[model samples]
Target: MLRLIAFAALGALVGGVIVIAVGPSTVGYTVAGIALPVFIIATVLTLIARSVGNAVGASPEAVQQAKDARRLGVARIDALRQTGTQINDQPLCELDLTVQPLQGSAFASTMRTIVPLTAIPMFQPGTERDVAILLDGGPEVAFIDEGELSPAERARLRVPGRGSVPFIPVEPHQRIVDGRRRGPLLGVGRAGRPGRIALFTVVAVAAAAIVVVPYHRAVGQSFAAMQDGRLRPDLRRPEALADAQRALEEAIGHDRVASITVAADFIIVEAPRSAGDTKTDRWTYRDGAVTHDGAATTQPESTAEQFSWTDVALDRVWTLMQDGAEQVDRPVGDALAYVVRATDDDVHSPAFGRPAGPPEIMFSVGDDYGTTSFVADADGSGLTAR
Candidate 1:
């Protein structure tokens, strides 16, 4: 699972880079049209290979049984000897004979006969002798006998008259199949750590390509909407607005919020309420007051007192800047235009009649374009040249 996650992340990274380079439009079609089917095919093939390999591999027990059957000693009963036969130092009840082998020492023909003394327990015709037979041929077939057998092991030898030797004494790790030897199983394949890592990396890259393209396209659409001013005003909400205010405040350190006023044709900057600072660049709006080369100034009709204004006015300025600055191609210059709040003595505007709050023209404008300062009326009549 960890490998899967890592692979996904790697895939996403690769996909994202591709999105940046090629544009999201092409990536989505390419992955959907080409990558998906290939991934499915590869996965199916891998599973099939694993299943077939397991089916053909030998079981551990089978392999061990084969080894046990090939041991130098165990012999099968071919035929019984005359009751009074004598061999070098022992009495033999049966004489074991062999078929001449086409190949040297093949187990296929070697266990044909056994000679044992009358005192020894003889198996019914086909049971193999448990004693170790000499590897080197000898007169009377020298066999070494171990003392006794466990009752459980001896009980297994009681099957009557089967032509083939049904039971062969087995060693540890040998497989018994109806008391016959078979095979040791083959190894199954497993992905090593490095191989697994590589696999995940490939998968992640593939997945990332599939996912990132669509996200890239969505972001592009959002950016285009933002640039066009067609986005919903309340889309982000109060939090977006607040975050935008904070960021603007920080950027324009020491500048009062009330001092900023949106120009009729200006840049608007703001944040959406729900997302706040996270999508500040995407959802925020900012509007600047429009200025022309020789714009006319407004003359005040009366005098008024200065007063602090709410952030509402600043919000309007941002909205207006986003909406208003469309075809206005003013020359770029070193001049900086700034909205500066009016001092008590400088608040002059016709709209500032005696009112409930300290009535004043809300804001003033200053720019490096000229030394002359000006004030803007609440209605945006024009800049009042100072």
Candidate 2:
């Protein structure tokens, strides 16, 4: 049962990964809805089958052992204690007994067995019953005989003349044989063999649905989007920057552009929420339109100056990116355009020899490998690799 639950949990984890990677969709929800009930039903059926098996008969191995056992004699029950353990509604009991073999003297020993509710009354202390031990086995390996005896025969065995022998202790790990029988581990005897196969089939089908359903759904959706020209974006061109800036300005009704990030498939633009507002708004421009990408957040006021989009000279920046790709031997991946205040160690300081200057546009470009970065001026004046 624990193994079955573990298997079901693993299937759920794999299904969760599929949903995360493909994004939530109708097919993903349907697969989860179906797989959950299937797993529960399979677990319940396995438990029921195991219970029925326990009530039926002993395992095949126990039956073979009984065939080879030899009768020892009557055993007088001295004490019986419950172990607080149960299997299939039967309590496990530790019994103290004196085994009087037909040939040898009576010896005291301990045995552990599972007693059914119906048989508890018959196992009380001072009761005498037939017992047996396996051939080449010790007295501690005794088993209760299943056969019934007449009242006269029971009276003859109770005659008080048997000599006493020393007590022999059995190891805790040893198993004591019980007369009751139980069915096989896999099913309820031979009749449940088909049920076991059916349970396995259910589990297999559940696992397949968990894996294949989400996979085909994601593939079909992606293919459909591609055919409709909705999955691909033409944002790699230099003009995409101007178009994104214009769209963001139009949507926000302001020119307070803070930053713009250009990538192969999309462009993100950040600007102030309104004219002279400290809070910032963000938008993603894809498929030639701008959409609100995130919530507005307050930003600290800065002394740095901002540049006009017309003065960006994106063509010069693209040329520098092409040159960078040649030097790095990798294609350009993304670019970020922002204004930065001139510092004492600014790149312009080498040429102008000034401690500070007006804010200038900073262009940062990276290769597809993401291991290298190149910085350039707004007018594409200088290229420095970092």
Candidate 3:
């Protein structure tokens, strides 16, 4: 679920970068880093699909639930205080406010998933609230935030229409005195279908463009590619004169090409999305000497060969875990991981190291990992892994 939210939110951002690169008009005017999609979310659609679920929801289940629970719980509390009801204060389950929502989509992030709940109120700023509300009957005793009693503006704030709502529970249903509406209620603000769709579209594109693309590509090239159709400069290629023709072909795959470059003798290949960050080592003729760029490096792919250890990282592993940024219920199963051999060395010396192996791949869904995975076909061609 977290993965879904991450993806959904990030997908929009990734999609955003793509569209933003396409046209300035696309990203110039966006709300937050998101844009609404054309269709309603599957959860919303599904909720709407079931008549009972929709009723339980549109009727403000969150609001009503909060209300009812507060009522009953308060009633029990009052009874306990007065020494009356025989229903001794039995320990009911602790009302857990953290609701694990149903599975969301690839784009749903923790913030995005919870964005829906934003509509249900009594859950907001500047008010006394129970850690968990109980509904039933009686004067509810809630731990009020200091602000509720603060004399700051208690005199000015009033209940809408009916004037003042005394901070009393005479009418359990109206226990929550609408003291200081604090401006019009945002939950009541309705977003038309068109506005919703537009918002989704904007967010989707933003995710694709900003979050995914930047992380996926090198410093300049990734941005240049999407925005200007310019391929990231394989810095390892240097002048491009030594292998101009092959370099051009190696650069453009038309179809997907799984390849990585180590600064070794030649490049190793693979069929994974991460041909960019696999840990790698390079040993080649550069500047004027066959110096080693570094004994160890972390990247998803390698473009050099023979003395390349791109596959060194293949032994290291990657997994999809919790990202507080994402809102998910379960694990995701489609995260991609890159494995490298570091360098390819034929010499018996320890420095001669093992030849880099093809990159390993992992897929993820939100916080889950190790589910569906596939190997890519590599041909030892194209740009060196950054």
Model 3 segments more than 4 A misplaced: 1-191, 216-386
Best by TM-score: 2
Q: Can you write out model 1's per-residue Cα lDDT over 113-197, one digit (the tens) per residue?
A: 2244454556444545543222222111223353333455444433223333222221222223433433334222343557665
* Clash list (residue pairs), candidate 2: 57-181, 57-182, 57-183, 58-181, 58-182
Measured against the true structure, the TM-scores of the candidates, in listed sequence, are 0.25, 0.34, 0.22
Candidate 3 lDDT (Cα, 0 to 1): 0.30
Q: Rate the local accuracy (lDDT) of all candidates.
A: 0.36, 0.55, 0.30
Which candidate gets the maximum lDDT versus the true structure? 2
Model 1 residue 99 distance off true place after TM-score fit, in angstroms: 26
For candidate 3, lDDT tens digit of each residue in 1-386? 22234345545544554444432323423522443432235444433222121111112343445444332111111110111211123211111122111111011000001112222233332222222122222122232233322353333323221112122222211223332112212111244546545655565565556643432323333344345454332222333213322332243322122333333123333322223433434332221112234434333333342222332222222212222113344443333333333343557544355434343333233333323332321322221211
Model 2's TM-score against the true structure: 0.34
Model 2, stretches more than 4 Å misplaced?
1-233, 294-298, 303-305, 334-370
Residue-wise C-alpha lDDT for candidate 2, range 75-137, written one tens digit per residue: 777888887667677887777777665545566777677778899888898887776543223
